[model samples]
Structures are given as C-alpha cells and as structure tokens.
Target: MPQPSVLIAGAGPSGLVLALVLLQNGVHVRIIDKERTHRIGSRAAGVMARTLELYAQLGVLNDILAVTSPFGPMASYDFGELVPKSKTAFLFEHQEPTPDIPYPNTEAVNQTKHEGVLREHLAKLGCTVELAAELRGFEQSAEGVMAKIMHTAEDGRQNEETATFEWLVGTDGAHSVVRKQLGLSFLGETRTEHVVGLGDIVVEEGLGMDVAHMWFINGKMILVRPDDVNNKMFSFLYRTSSAEKPLTREDFVEEFYRITGRRDVKFGEATWLSKYTPNIRMVDTMRKGRVFVAGDAAHCHTPTGGQGLNSSVQDAANLGWKLALVYKKLAPASLLDTYAEERMRVIAHMLGLTTALGDTNRANMGKKDFKMQHPDAMRMLGVNYRGSSIVCEEPGAAEGVDDPYMGGVGGRVQAAYRAPDASELVPAGKQDKTTRLFEMFSASRHTVLVFGGDAGTRAPVVKALEHFPATGVIHAVLVLGQGNATPSDAPSFATVLEDRAGHAYKGYDVDTGELAVVVVRPDGVVGVVASDAEGLERYFKKILIAA
Candidate 1:
C-alpha cells in the first residue's frame, strides 16, 4: 500500500512551515507553489518575538538566528528618520512579557530571508517546494481528498497529474487556487484609501545606511533592512503617493523622495515592487471535510502591524499537531474541523487590529507619526486552542480562563509552570526553566493528569492508568503540594511526587482548590479538566479508551 499524502498548496512561509512541522512527525507531504520561484521581495518583515521562540523550539534556532540581525535598542521617532543606529530618538520598543522565554525580540527579516530559512528547513525533511504547479480540480469523500494538479517543467510542457490524500490544505496565498476549488468565500472588504509600496533595492550609501534604515516622514514610511543572503541587498516598503500612479522603478524612487525629503539617493537594481490597495480579507470558513485553507488563504491581515506572517505560522503550528494526530488515526475526524474554527477566530482578530492600525497609518501620513503599539497584538504568538474537541478543557473551566501555553516534548522535561526550584533547571544546554513537565509528555497518547492526592482521586486515576497501559500510554502525575511526598514513603504511593509546596499547581499555572484529576492530551493541552474526578474512570474507560 502507498503511504498517506498531505497536499499542501503555496510554499510561502506558512505553508512551508506547516509542511516542515508535519514532516517532523514523519508525515508525508508535497508542497506546491504557483510561482515558478521563491519570492525574493521584502513582502513581510516583522517576525514577532513569539514566532522566533517557536522556531527555536522547532530546532532551527541556531541556523536562522545566526544570519538574522538583532533588532533592539530600536527607536521610533516622530520628527526624524526611523533608522537603526547605535542610538535613536524614537523608541518603538518590543519586549518579552515573561523573562523565562526571552527570545521575543523581533528583527526585520524580509520575506526572502525567512523563505530561505523555511526552504532550508523543508529540504532537511526530504521535501522540496514544487514550483510552477497549480491545482486545477479536487474532490473529497468519506475516504479522502483527491487533487488534480497541473505542472509545467523546464520544457514548458504542462502535465496534468492526480494526487489523492486523506487531507489537503490550501496555503496558496490570497488568490488561492485551492480555496477557489473548495468554493470558500473570502469574506472581508478591500481598503480603498492608501497604496502600500514594497520593493527590493540597493541604495547609494550616506543617506544614513549604517543599520536597518527606515524613514517615518510625510505621512509615509520606508523600511530598509539588510539582506546579505541576496548580495547585501536592502529591501524597502514605502507608501505610494496616489492610487492613479502606476508603480515603476522611477516612480518607486521618486515617491520615496516626495515622502522622505530626500531625492539625491540613487536606488540601485530593483526586484519586485508591488503597489497594493491595502485590502483586508478572510475566508468565511477555513475547512471543508478533507480540505482546509490556512495563512492568507484563510485570512489576509492588513500588513501594518506585522501580524500576517507570524499569524500564518501560528496557524500552521496549531493545525500541524492536530493534522498529524488525525492523519495517523490517533484522533477522530471531527478534531480536524477545529483547525478552521480555531484559526478563523484568531485571524479575524488579527485582521481587525491590523485594519485599525492601517487606518491609523493613512490618517497620520502628514505627521509621519505612524506606530503600531498594541500589547494584545503580541498575544497571537502564544495562542493555544483549549476549546477544540481534541483539547478536553477541565469541567467548570472558568469562562475566559486564560490557558497557560505549555506542552512537553515526550519526556520528563519540565514545563515553564512555576516550579519550587526553577533556579535548578536554568543552564541545561539551551534549556530554560520554561520547559515544563507538560511539554515533555508524548501527546500521541492521552495522558491522565491526576491532580489531587486524596484516595478518591488517586484510586481511580491509578486504576485508569493501569487499565489504559496498553490502550493509551498514560503518564500518571501527582500534582501535590510542596513536601507532599517523600522517598521513604515512595513505595506506599508508588507513582506520586510531592507537590513541592503546591508549586506544581502554581507552576503549571492551574487552579487547584479541589479538582481531583485532570486528563491532558498528547499535545500538552487539557483534555478532560475533570469536574471532580467523578465519572473519571468511565471517562478513561468509556469516553477515551473507546473514545
């Protein structure tokens, strides 16, 4: 029998990230792009601090981080040029909220730089981005999804081929072919006021080009970041003067002066300069049976606040784990539907925020004082879907209960939850205190989270753990108060660990008044936040063992 297939459309960062994440779990995927080559322009440059941490978790931290520039001590001025220097007048600073995870520094990485990182990562997974390929037709059934694709080779001959898989994903950008085939409606309005200009160019120095140089003037802006990967080239994003003017090489340079008060700067060779109407769009739906859409295919955030790339990458990460589980038959089909629901909800908020900020940019064109400084905007990087079916939120989970984003890497690795001795786990070779015990657990099997130390809770939890030993490998944990357990009494409570002074509960950042047990899914998300550990055994035996 042939292996399972995942047909991914679009080789942009999000699509490529999805393919790489899925491939890490040994899933077979074929990533396709309508463009014959990777885009080298600086389309999206703002990589959120949270996204950088995700990449670090994925094991590509050293490779990508080495080439990327550090964006700190940065400034955002109201009356001067927004250039990267040793010092600055305007401070558009972004800082990590929690010290445990400190890599939340977002530098200006162009789409080209990031795409190179993603492409390199994808290659390591034995998958290559297929260029000059387009999806023409596809169909889904109870069994799987079948895709009809057309490929054009170096010979320029177009060949039609068929790919059948249990699942198909549309990452094919705003004008997604996969989305169109699925008839998913892009439900949002296009903004009409300002024209967003983006291009790649090498400028003649002394216009103050020491660090990443940006000019915030004349109600317009230009972001010039260094891209050594492309021969020390600097990419730019400036606002177009009017909608009527067609963006050409000459127009792109002339407009920069008209806005920034500099006309003597000789702009070097040009790559791709696009003039967009700054539209915001999102699909009314993201999933249809075996077919799903992600990234711009799902929702197009206004590109002002830099949420588009990170948001898309987060969508891939959220859907990657679930898709891996369901594709492997470890979860029910209904669980796959949650991808659209969860991501659609997130992208909607991103779009709303980005649109509001874009309006702010258009409004502040004269003063040139456009700055995106929303703290809530950073929340997208750390989003988790406790509401999804695959996640079993505990009973009476508080309405609007903020989920502590924690997941184990299938081991005894500690989660960043507050531990009695957080100071002990600091320098374990790139390991931080944030590596929680939750992240160390293998999410492939439903792990039983036994909360309390009482006989009522421990008895049923132990029984279920033993019962599901073969059915589901259960990692029985005892989140007791500090000094609750001792080695001398180890045999009496064979699998119990002292709560470390109620530190585990506090560390995991969970409420621990009297909840007897909690069951965690393989993904380190709460599966069954048990009401009282009542019907607890049946939950394992009935809902889970059978579920």
Candidate 2:
C-alpha cells in the first residue's frame, strides 16, 4: 500500500515537529511557511519540563539543550535600588528530580533558536520547510483534502498549485487562515489594555547576564534578561499604555532610562522590536473531518506562562502518532477523535492559567506580590487527560477526579496521565548496562509494561499477549521484581527487565503479588491500565481495527 501523505501549514516549531514525527513513522509530509524568512528574536522563552521529555523521546532533547541555558536567580529593582531579597522570576517553581521524573526544571531559549533545532532535525529526516509558500485555501471530503498553495519566486512571480493529501494540519500562528477557512470560531477576549513592547536588543554593557533584571517604577514594569544567544545580547519587555507610534530602538532605550532612573545604562542596537497585545483565543474544536489545526492555529493565549510553543508542539505530538496508526491500518479512524477530546481540555485550562498569570502580573506592577504568579500547575507535568475516551483503567481503580489544570489526583501514574520515566533497570542476571523506561517507547509502537505477579498469575497474561508481536504495534515489556528469576515460559516476544532498585514498581504503584499492565501510548501518555488479558483486549478493541 502507498504511504499516506500529509500537508502541514506553517513552518514554526509546531508544524516542524508534526512533520518530523510523521516522517519518522513512515508518513509522507510536505511542510510550508508563509514567511519569506525564518522567525527571529526571543518570542517564546520558556521550555517546560514536559516538553523536554517529549523532545527526549524524539531524540532532539540534547540538540535543544545544547543551545539553551537554565533559568534562575532573577533580581528585582525598585526605584533605582536593588532589592535586598533576590527572587526567582520564572513562571514555575523548580522541583528536585526523582527517579521517575527526569527533567525537573524548565530551560530558557528564544523561539527562533528552538525552531532552528526542530528544522535541523526535520532536515535529517529528509524533509525541509518550503519558504515563501502560502496556503491559499483547502476543501476536505471523506477520503482526503484538496489544498491550494501559492508559491512566490525570487523574481517576484507567483504561481498557484493544487495538491491532495490524506490529512491537513495548520500550525500557522494566531491569524490562521486554515482555522478561518474552516469557519471554526476563535473565541476569546483580547487584552488591548495590557499592551507591552517586547523584543531583543544588543546592549554594550551595564546589565548582569547571570540574572534577570526587573525594574518596577512609576506603576510600570520593565524586564531585561540575557539573550540565550549570548551575554552581549538581551531581550526586554516594557509595559506602557501609550505606544501610539511604532516602538523603535530609541523608544526602548529612552523607556529603559526613565523606568530604571539610571543614566549609566546603555543600548547598542535594537535588532528586533514589536508591540504585544495579549490575545486569548482558541478554536472550539481542533479537528473537522480530514482537516485539522494544531498549535497556535488551535489556541492562542497570553505569553505570561510561556505555554504557547510547548502546548502547540504537544498538540502535534498527540496528533502525529494517531494519524500514523490510522494510515497504517493498525487503528480505527475513531482513534483520531480522542486528539480533540484530550487536547481541547488542556488548551482551555492553559488559556485560563496564563490569563490569570497575566492578570496577576498586571496587578503586581509596582508591588511585591511575586508569590501570586508562580505555581506548580504552571510546570505542566500535572496536566492530564484522565477522561479521554481511549484511556482504559482497570476496574475498581481510583480513576481520580479531573481538574482543568491540576489533572487527576494520584501520586502514581494513572490512565491518560503522562507516563513517568524510571531509570536503572537491569536485565535478569545481566550487569553490563542499565535501561530507562522512556527508551522503550517509539513513534511506531505502544509500550506495554507488565508487572509480573506469581508464576501462576503472570503466565496467563504474558501468554495471551504472546499472540501480539512485540516488534509490531505493541511492544511488551516484562518487568520483574528484584532478585526474581526470569520464568522459562516467558514469551519470546517480550523484553525482560529486573527492577534492581525497585523504582519501576514504586513509581508505577504496582502491587507486590498482583498482575498489572500499564500501556503507554506512542506520545508517552498512559493509554490503558489493566490487570488482566481480557481488559487489555478491550483496550486494543477500542483503538485498533480488526483485520
């Protein structure tokens, strides 16, 4: 059978990630960008820990970390006097890493560099972003979508082209043509009253590169932080009601002196500048038939919490694997609906959280109310889809209640929750190497963690799963307790691992003598939690199509 083809609109981080993931899953993809040149400046600065975990799975976390720095030790200034107390200015508080949670802190890098990392990875997969190409319109039917794209040549000649694809995805920014064309309502309010000037600039000297500097004077706030590129370059955001004329380099310099009450500060050049009016809007639904929208195309929110790019890229991750499965005929088309069902909930809560943070920021302009801004929820590790249609939990499981932002109430991994990563697992009687749970997941297969019970209870579950090939849709992993011998009757298709430190069992909350199966989706979300073979069969029935 021919591989399914997908067209991704917009070459931002979201579009590029979706394309890269689809290509890795053996899907054909064509990515396009409306902008003639790539985006620049420190637009979205915060890369959440959850996003870093996904990047690790995609094998681009190291590349991204190479270009970024850890965010910390923010300093505040009041009326030209440095505050005696130093406080962290990030949106989320830092947590110490545990055995299950690997990345516990957020990383800071400008969106421009972030997109560049994704673009390079996409190129490695034999795909490149087509620049100066615009998606004019599209119409989708039962089988596929007919898209009209316009390409502009260097000679200023424009040519129209038509293409057909099995699916269409829009990662285009806030003013997404795909969303508008589909007539999906971008519903929400625009905070014009809270306008600010945001951009990157070159400073010859004066500001400390080690810490973020914030000056709150005359009931206005101006923040300056070192650019991820280098110390000589910095990014600034100044809140002002009057930006009647376009904000220029002179305007930023002049405003900086006025707000800081210091004549010694110097500005070399303003490489980029723009006005930001917070727009809180999102589509009612992320998908309509064969055409879909992800990232900024699906939702837009205040940049207070820095959830924009992370949320959008996650949307791509959630949709990419599902599309690949449907095309490969391993899953039914109904599996696609769960993307909208799951992401919409997270996006809606994210919009509210960021909006609240923006409001708190505006309220604390000249006050010392920094405590109201940062919260654990902003870390995004707590975000879950407990109510997703495809998430199957064992009978009588707690199934914890769901909150819009905090997710379910559980200390351990639950259905539809982000799968916790456990490290230092050793093969039975093998001492040479250690393995992590995350290494078992791939874009092409589901990871099934089987917590072995007694020989009597474990054999049936393992034997029944033997019918499903581990190299195919399901990759079964037999996790044995410490000092337990590998059973001779263990399925040949399964990969056996001994939890040397007991971290896997404790992290996953598996009972000592009860059989349990934790099925993780391709995107690393907990898909199904079952205790028996019949329960696992029901989950596959819901997602996979019968041949």
Candidate 3:
C-alpha cells in the first residue's frame, strides 16, 4: 500500500477522532484496532465542556446531545433515611452560559455510545475502522515509521504486512503495543484493594429515572444512574469490600438490596458486568521521533472526575492540527514537541485531582454523612498552554497567562488559552443572520482576527499577512466596528467581517479605534495577542514556513 500521511493504531475514541479530524483536513489516515467487535458497555460516562466544544467543531455534538441528557440529580440514602440535597453529587450548580463560553455544563454519556457516534461520522467522511488488525511492532526513522500490523481473517488465518507512513499515532488503550514497542515508561500506581464492580441492569420496578440514587453502608458505596435507553434502565457502580472475594452480578444486586433495605427496587437481569482494579499510570512522554501515543496509551487514572475519555479526545484534538501542519510542510516538526509538553502538565494535574477524589471515595465509604461532590475544575475549561515556547505573549503583561483576551494585551488574558467563543459576527455579503467566532475557527487552520482598527492600522497588518506565503494554512479576518465599512485597500485575500453587536471586540479585549490582533490556532487556542502588523508577522514567522 502507498504510505499514508498518518497511520493510527487503535480505533477507540482517541484514534477515531484523530482520524476524522485529519481526514477533514484532507490528510490520508489509516486507523485500525485489535478488537474484532465494537465495544458494548457503559464506561467513562461524563463528557466535559471542552470536549463538547471540540465535538461541535467535528459536527457530531448535536447527534451526541440527541442521545444524552443532563446527569439526573443524585439522591443518597443513609440506612433508608434520605440525605440532604446539599450532599448530592455535582457539588456545584450548572454554570449559566455566557456569551464568551457557550458550553458551561457537562453531558452524561457513556463511552460505547460516544464511540459509535464518532464512528458513524467517520464513515460519512469516507473512512471505516479496520477491525481485528493489530499493531504487532514498528521501527521509526527520521523520515517515517515502518509498522508491522497483523490482520486476522474470519477463517482464523493471520496475515502480517509491513506498511510505511510519515507519522504513527498510538491511541491504543493502557496496555498499548505501540507504547510498549517504543519502550516508553508508564509510571504510576495501582491498588488491587480498590476494586469497583459495575453493570448495566434492567430495573424490575421504576426507580425515578430523573435522579441518580446511591447508598452508603458497611464500608461500601453503591450508585445507580439512568442511561439514555428507555424502559427504566440504570447503570450501577459499587465498591467491593477490601476483604471480600471476587465480585459477581448477583453479589452487586444482593448488596444493593441489603444497603437500601428496600425490596421495591429490584433488578431483572444485568446486560453488562465487570470488575477492575483502580490504576493511575501515564507515559513520561507522549511522542518519540515519528511515532506518538495518546489517550489511555499516554495516561490512565481512576474515573473519579470522568477525565479519561474527555482528556483523550482533547489529546487527539490537540495533536490532529499540529500533525497536519507538519505533514503539509507548512510548519516544522518541532511543533509536535508541544503536544507532549502541553498535554503532560494537564494530565499530571488531572492525575493528582482524580487521585485525591479516589481518596475521598475511600474515606466516604462507610460514613453516614457521605457527600458525593463534584468540583468545578472537572469541567476542564481552565486548561491552557501559556508556558509553551510557541505561545507568544505581549511584554509587561501578567507574565505567564491571562484570563480573557477581551481584556486586550494590557488587560488580563492568557496568551495561549482556549480562545473564547463569541457571536454576532456578520460574514461579508450575508446580512440576514450572524455567525460566531467558533464557526469561523472550525479547526481547519490558524484564524487571525483584526479587532476594531482603522484602515491605517489594519491595512499594513493585512498587507504584511498577504506577503507571507502561508496563506493556505492561515485564515485572516477583519472585524470592523458596526458602522465602519471594509476599506477598498484591504487585503483581497482576507475575509472582511462586521462585529455589529460589539461582542467580538468586547470578548477579544479590544476597544473601539484601538488595534489588536488575536491569532487562533487550528485547535482553537489563542496563539498570540499582538498590537500591530509587526507583532503578527513575528508570531507567524516562528510557527509557519514559506509556501
């Protein structure tokens, strides 16, 4: 086979997303997994806000929303006595949406269904998952990777082929062959005593599907939440006693009845059942030469904060655009290094947070006043890449990071933060309706927004950007005041837009008559916040190559 631009091993969420995003950008990718069948289970059930935004860009968010609902309110009982409302899970109320942040709440969805939605969209994009194809081994050179993949036939025959690709990404799970072949260190801890038994069961009697129910008794915590499926279906996760033997579906049901002390809540049969030891492990590095590791291949933690799948999806989102740039030769290979640097810190922080939450779980096991609390940080909107070498911040600013670019360069804003979403952008020649900054971003290329500047200040910036040969990989947009018209001398290559409601300027932190330039990366991060044409040129010169 001819070498693809990229080869992806493991058709899980991370690998599938990486393939779809790359394919959307016109990059050829081959994605394969060792599993013979699609997954079936309720694993990793919380989808954070950041992942939702990325899903919107991928065009699958609405479909996912159609199949999911807000996490039902959590109800806890102590020996049949109901706990107070404050003690329920989700410690914080859902954050009200602001103009700058469209998605402020998490959606409750399982891993299996989420992957199914992603695969459906990938098929629509003309790509299919090659199942029963395992990555046996590989060797990497400066030019690319030669991988040996074993394909299993229906007749029980196996055929191995050696394929070459410019890049190889391992989105394989924790026990990843790619990570093992690369000899990367997955350093962390695992505790056999901390075991969680989970299952999907049909409720014989209707337990109000509007709320998640839980019981704490005799050193155990049992939780039940509604799934998207109808017919009073619920997914359960419970802690097994450290001294208890291996758990079975009958054990879970018996314990559930014993704790609640109620025969009214009954289970007919379990659709899925499994037991797992809680483990927290992460790769020291995400990339080595031309091969890379993402998702569980890179990090795995207890699902306390539901960060597993969300973090993995973000990892693919972060790496997808950078890989495409390198494949097109529009950016240098060093850009890939930022993938490790940026993701490592976030994963480390996530590990620490989830570990602490696991400790909370153990502590609250037998307590009468157990509170199932969720933290605000779990939403994952605060992650940023301010300290990265590629992120250029203006001088005399807050130094490391800024809160909102709407505050301007001098105002408080992080240079490498996720660019805030804004609305009321009128695309040129369209007057009937307005658009959004996210709609313009779309993750295909870098987006340059020139905010509230006169032609004198904006003209030179546009001209200088046109002079750069990297226009194919960088998109330029001019956001003028509601009354100001596009200057006749404006760069013909640039897209002229009107911020009629002033949300763009306000959200991006530029005052009327004051010139500001915000450069958004393909992954929708604010790359640089500059004040002039010279600053814009300087930012691009560091990341882009001549066309």
Q: Give the number of the best model, judged by lDDT.
A: 2
Query: 1-547 in candidate 1: lDDT tens per residue?
Result: 2464798988888898888878876689988887887787777776776576566546665776766665533233333343332344222355643423445466666678678988898787678888998888898998898888899988898999897888889998888888888887887787656667777777755344334556665456665555653354666677665667666888777766666655556677787777777668888888888888888888876677678888888788768867876666655666677777666756766677677766765666545334444444353434455355444444443236434332222322222111111112221222223233433344234455555445554554455455443533455655445434332323323244444335456544455546455554443334454545444554444223233
TM-score of 3: 0.92
lDDT of 2 by residue, 40-144 (tens): 988888898889888888889999998888876677776666442456565456678888888978888988889999999989888889999999999899989
Candidate scoring better on TM-score of 1 and 3: 3
Question: What's the number of clashes in each of the models?
Answer: 34, 0, 5
At residue 47, give the lDDT of candidate 2: 90
TM-score of each: 0.78, 0.94, 0.92
What order do candidates take by TM-score, descending? Answer: 2, 3, 1
Which is the better candidate, 1 or 2, if ranked by TM-score? 2
Task: State the lDDT at 411 in candidate 2.
Answer: 80
Q: Lowest-scoring 10 consecutive residues by lDDT in candidate 1?
A: 418-427
* Runs in model 2 lying further than 4 Å from the true structure: 1-4, 82-91, 229-231, 242-245, 369-372, 394-401, 467-471
Cα error, residue 336 of model 1, in Å, equals: 1.4
> Of models 1 and 3, which has the larger lDDT?
3
In candidate 3, list every pair of residues with a backbone clash. 402-413, 402-414, 403-413, 406-508, 406-509
